[model samples]
Target: MLPESHASPDRKRRPFLLLVLVLVALLGVGGYVAFQLGGDDRAPVANEPAPETDQPSTEAYQPWFAGYTDLTATPVFTFETPDSESGRDVVLSFIVAATTDACTPTWGTYYTLDEAVEGLDLDRRLARAEQLGGQVIVSFGGLLNDELSTGCTDPARLVAAYDEVIDRYGVSTIDLDIEGGNLRDTVAGERRAAAMATLQENRTAAGTDLAVWLTLPVSPAGMTEDGATAVSQMLEAGVDLAGVNLMTMDYGASRADGDSMAEASIAALQSSHRQLGMLYRLAGIELTAATLWTKIGATPMIGQNDVAGEIFSLADAAQFNAFAQENRIGRMSVWSLNRDQTCGSDYVDLTRVSNSCSGVDQGDQRFSDVLAQGFDSRPTSAAPIKTTEEAGQIGDLTDDPATSPYPIWTEGSTYLADTQVVWHRNVYQAKWWTLGDLPDAPVLNEWETPWTLIGPVD
Candidate 1:
């Protein structure tokens, strides 16, 4: 989402009393008893064991707090504020291609990496946030501007651009918010998938984790065709995708007349879960329902969405958070931390979208407070735990016609769309007319081959 032109107003600090009430509401009576027994009113320490509850522990819940911070918003966001009431983990967003050089990354196409370090005081603030046990996940791409992969056609240059940002930021997790033309361009999608696959491989070989998440626009029905293709390209290129985070806002005509914002978001998430399950299966990996839930995330525009009549309120935030915790979604994020607070009386139009303040009534309630209710973990903690040895192992089993469910694929044969064949002990379906392209080709891009892997032989 693009920022509005209005200047930022004075910051309002959350009251300490509100924090205590939030803690009590989240921790229940058992926690209050423990607090009284301890004879101290200090907030619980980070990573401390939570008091016993009938529901699942915070550890079991996969909802980690990474509220998006519009780095280039007006008046700037003080993410490193020591006593800030917002959650510790912040998602510094929209690291897009530089206006001059597509291969060079810039923040919202406004400041170069070094320039941001100086002008935004980014490096020092980031260091201070880390000192306070806070981590940041850099998000690339947004509603506007060109994402690096779309602008940099050369695969090597694209990979280098991604590497530069990852290396510079020292971030293990990155979110690719593909939308608009970037999402629909099949060629760019292929290029991105290949580059990400290479980047992940390099990081894996170096004994470092590079968790990648695809943030795409979605509706209550589920991910659009282009959105699904974007994800398919990533998986087909061998990128161990961390998760699929749906932009659960701006439904427009997609939302039913009677549905609340929370209801619509939940429906979108539920549909996305099913869609992702099928996508994973097509990539020859089948995940359990619970495991697949962890591979999904939801992000709603906090308040006053670009689409008229769409406002995600505080009540909606609470309901959505409850659903996320219940299903153990991998991550939770809002449109921006910059807009978490309510607008002042100066704002003449509440309907007009603002970057500095949320155009809604927030009575001692920050969107971050409600959205990040039980998400106590960091973004890095969401990375899939795997050893280098396990990652290095590759299966080389052959397909046998006796055990296969379909006829063995042959290079000489031209296959039509929907034609299923067996290759290397896996089932694949042809997406279009093809000949000589290997179903098991060691191609980086999905468009390089005609076959789509359906699953391993059962």
Candidate 2:
């Protein structure tokens, strides 16, 4: 049922503080990832494989990407992950433009048409992303913004605004994210048709090959006959309709009922997946992307906890995975990654080679004691930084911010990031690395886990 050791009740749900120790041991301490530090200015670099001598001869691996933070366009560095088909593969993250600031409509104020278009016009944000499924479409509506649907309801004005956004963002596709509205309203059908008409008009006027898409509500009640008919209207509009992105979260919000965050997320994904399948069959339209959940943020309907752990798990299920696998709809785009905590969950450890056993395997007793003693230390070593390949083979990089001021000193090491040193395990096979010698050890952020492993090497 659980993915691996990750399923253990102790590992999955340990005391918050103790869990930090285990995770730190697994990931490492104060090692800033190459991408996170580079920020928005970073650009895509041609991937150069490490030389044979440097890259260990191993089996090949499959590479799946993680989406980058919002507002960030380029990937800081491509890293390797363990793979079954291949020993290793590179996963490329596609970062898109998500307006969480003034673009949000949750607080009562809605962005005007001009402001909405301008906010979504993030250059190089989605422009240079590696194409997982053609152009990484710039999504318009999300959990925050309601004006895109409310204000841009006019056929002519909406078309013009749509054109401006596509041209400005240089995106080949668009995701129409109109969420949470009753389909029985008087203007519901007209409003949706007008929206589709705007997309068609924009496509023709811009002369750019554009795919118009909608993010439909997943529940049966959310998709009444009127709602399903509105979706069919888009097909008749002669626009190259892409696919519906299921709003696979916030299922309980319909009834205003309370449900576990995880269960709500899974239910939404399942409901949307089932509804979309039926709609496609009845409407006789071919679908492109089976994407889910347009955004992830602080709201109860679409929060961070359910988005990553629960929603993603549903995405990986056998049924959905098969559809995605077979149909080339392999892309899973979260509306914004910036909204998520860089440190991820609270269970993350923030300490260096110290042995608190947060998430890492603990074999060294002394290392654990040292971590507790110098808990606030930093790595002060001057050794050359190892490449990601080297880091993977060697011991995990430490994430402890406390060790930021110290150097990383290896006590008994088998290998330190591709460099063979005199480090050896004890008679009982205990191993350790000293933080006193590592230079450029990461300084931990309050929200950051000191033991979180990062950087290209990690």
Candidate 3:
């Protein structure tokens, strides 16, 4: 079901808004291609040079994680409250590099989790954390980590693996990080039901509290107004959801703002927190986690463009503290800190984070300490505002081969000009492009054009 907010008679089934960049307008096209080609949620985006901008001060945050660290090897590090603070909130995240068995990718070649894990040497890290009584977790999948996608989407296969992890590692929870991947032609409900069934089955077999966490996309800060409808569609399908983790980093892609990266990221994080949390409530769900990233890249390339030489350093520690204090969010999960540049070598100093990073007493060392303090806080009323004239509506092109992939306004809407709809595949949603810029696009023949179908044109 669409969120009640969008289910009214006046509303149409469409996304909240579209960030249609002319140069990167191809981004939407590429996203559709990746969606169709990969088949689930694992499509790849064309790597392009990111736009440039001045960095904000050390206080703000941006949109997504440019890079991450896997903690599959050593598990334990003790974090303490800073000397002057009484209590501070925290968020700790860990990624699973890989498993031992081979899992086939939906599109690409097959690879084993062992390949990823062995290379990263994360098991020793996990064991170390276990010995020290630190709460080390295992995150499954990433932007292109396709193996887990193969294993996790299937109920039977997922159940077997879930049992093995519990027995072998005594892990009580597992996180699923599904980002740009595949999009199937299958009905949305069918996909959601299948995924949810798998999660429920795996959880039942594990016998412990099994958590399934998802990291979602947020364009810069709270630019979710554009994607809110799409998100509602996802929830209706049943993706075995537990909570949402907003990858609140890299807002504006940081091309324009060079100096104030941290401050920018912080502001974006706060806006994203408020906006997304409101959307979740309007759609009826809980906001479980709010996390930040260590750094963001300038382009789609994996590691080439970092925002600044060093991101979120101790100099910026006060920024995070202040932001968290204002938002009342419980924990702050910094994207894997292992990638941060230290005195000479790259090392993630978790202690540099907040008043809680300094060494503390043993009794205070628990996973609970990592939670953000304001998890229960929320606004009593929805933010007041005037709705956009262009409320939620699907793109002009339906991509349905049954009809010409041309832009046709629905009965309730008006068309200013003819539109072009491109169809890429069976499962693809139609794409719309304005005819204004296309030098050779077919012009709408008003005299012979069908009237009611395109709606009464003004």
Candidate 4:
């Protein structure tokens, strides 16, 4: 999740006394709490406590599950570590531009796709994981190297490069972890969007589909301006985005001093929900709060973050997991599977971020065990990719009031939140007070309107 340069042996330690004070506050508050980072000069960040809601009786909430694996890290991950949970999906990262050819893709800068199959035995390991009921989601881009679009100048070759990786891996879902310079390059963003749209369309025409997820960096304030633009570009290009995965770590100065990593993450997700809703509406789509949650995903940097004094401990994992389950978020992921375990005794400094070991004291726990607690579903189970023509069928249907269970929606009538109405033979509920917004509008994005499609009236 972080480049090599971001790691340093020198970092300010969180004072033990301050930590104890924060723990005492948490005990008294009896809900989600935020703690100040000791030695941090930034102002203390404060986040509202998580709203209280009745906890679900059963562990039935199942979001798609995957944990990132750094493909080029030392002590190579074989997908069979003893700490790994059975049937857990792994997101192999990253497929970046080859040093020799910008259009050629490699697993980080280390191994070509075919070379990895032979050298790393990647193909066999993937098969073994699949045999055990696990799936793979190939992640492209990263903090270090050039993502395909950033370096590849030609449009045709960019699309081909992505296609080659997808074809080689035989994966349906792909994550684009656009960050750093890649996120800011508007031209690259457009090129990436266009290339993905073309690739998706070509695949659909050939009787297959691609589920693309934009993995962008975020702060407690929500998505950065460039990130929102990247998403907007994707929507404008007619790409049916699977979801937006937030990199909920390394907040830097954006995180207030006292805010716990989990609290900051929750605040980021909530803010992003509102921002994404507005973006979808601008694109003429309306999605329900529930549906929007499914279109959002969170990936926390487990154990220690790149920024000094920001540690995401096991307790934070439990709190974040509960929030994800309560909100029914679509996906849950960690920054890496490589750093899931505790550091060995030889490693002296626990504050320094490491590529191989988590800078924490894990008595006998794995980050995946806590983060992937209730997320039992596979990543491939995400909503299917729908073509524009397929999505257009909603507008062609007519609603008959005689058979509709709810009142037929009228443009002149004001509807309050939770008001249900019939449109195009389907039930829709208003997310908030609105008048004149069509429930059955021919919109491409779900967040474009104020109505949420419940289901077809039987």
In model 1, which residue pairs have backbone atoms overlapping below 3 Å? none
Ranking, lDDT, top scorer first:
4, 1, 3, 2
The sequence of per-residue lDDT tens digits that candidate 3 reaches over residues 36-68 is 011122221111001112222222222211122
Tens digits of lDDT, candidate 4, 65-94: 788877667777766433466226888888
TM-score of each: 0.73, 0.39, 0.44, 0.73
Model 4 stretches with alpha carbons more than 4 Å out: 3-62, 80-82, 383-458
Q: What is candidate 1's lDDT per residue for 65-173, written digit by digit as tens?
A: 7878778877677888733545588888779998898989999888999999888889999999888888889988876678898889888888988998999989999
How much lDDT does each candidate structure score? 0.71, 0.30, 0.30, 0.71
Where model 3 places Cα greater than 4 Å from the true spot, the runs are 1-68, 71-125, 150-155, 162-167, 182-197, 201-207, 223-234, 237-242, 252-259, 278-305, 308-310, 340-458
lDDT of 2 at 426: 8
Model 2: per-residue lDDT, tens digit, 1-458? Answer: 00011211000000122223433553364000000011223221111111112221111111121221222122222112211111111111221122343212221132333353355343332333333222234444332324334444455555555555556545554555443332223253355456666665555675545545554444312233333444555654544444444443323333334444333433334333333443443344422212211111011111222222322222122233333233223123321222222222454542221111222222332111221121111111100111121223333334343433322325332333323121111011112322322222211121131121221221
